[model samples]
Target: MKEGIFFGEGMKFVKDDYPDIYDAVVGLNKAAYTGKVLDYKTQKLIAIGIVAATGDETATEKQMRSGMNELKITKEEIVDALRVVLLTSGMPAFTKAMKVVSKL
Candidate 1:
């Protein structure tokens, strides 16, 4: 069985630990601020894209997996997002991310 990230005590050393609670708080803020600041769905996609774009393989993998699980993002959408990153971030980052994404 694969272990997914959890928001319990063990992860507090990482920034934005307690993601379960942090997500809730962010949700509340989004609701309060006219409910259209950054859509949750879009935020998830953007986060996955940014992580992948930056070539942070560990974070990119984690965010991609989580975003897919939580948001039902299609593999095609993930691929398309990576393509855009390739255009903007150049080959090195793109190739690195592609290797990891391909493995998944």
Candidate 2:
């Protein structure tokens, strides 16, 4: 991953200390994000919702930022995705994610 790309956990330490594990994870991410079916933007939208459902503020912001920066996705599109979190994950998670999204 690029130095500032907000990829999983940086993975630098893992690469240094545990090359095998790090390689496996990198392969897994590559396979998962192949984007042969759903395009990457849709995948990103789903990712945002999943992370938002967990109510992880930092992650939510990072996802939104990455989506915006990398895919040029709009806040409205992200809000649409968050609505799913609202239904499936409930008010607290939805509200928390919405708050973060709102700032962006």
Candidate 1 achieves a global lDDT of 0.68
Overall lDDT per candidate, in order of appearance: 0.68, 0.87
Residue 29 C-alpha lDDT in model 2: 72
Candidate 2 global CA lDDT score: 0.87
lDDT of 2 by residue, 1-103 (tens): 2223436675778888998988787777777787899988899899999999999999899899999989999999999999999999999999999899889
- Name the regions of candidate 2 deviating beyond 4 angstroms: 1-10
Q: Among these predicted structures, which one has the highest lDDT? A: 2
User: CA shift at 104, candidate 2, in angstroms?
Assistant: 1.5
Off by over 4 Å in 1: 1-10, 13-38
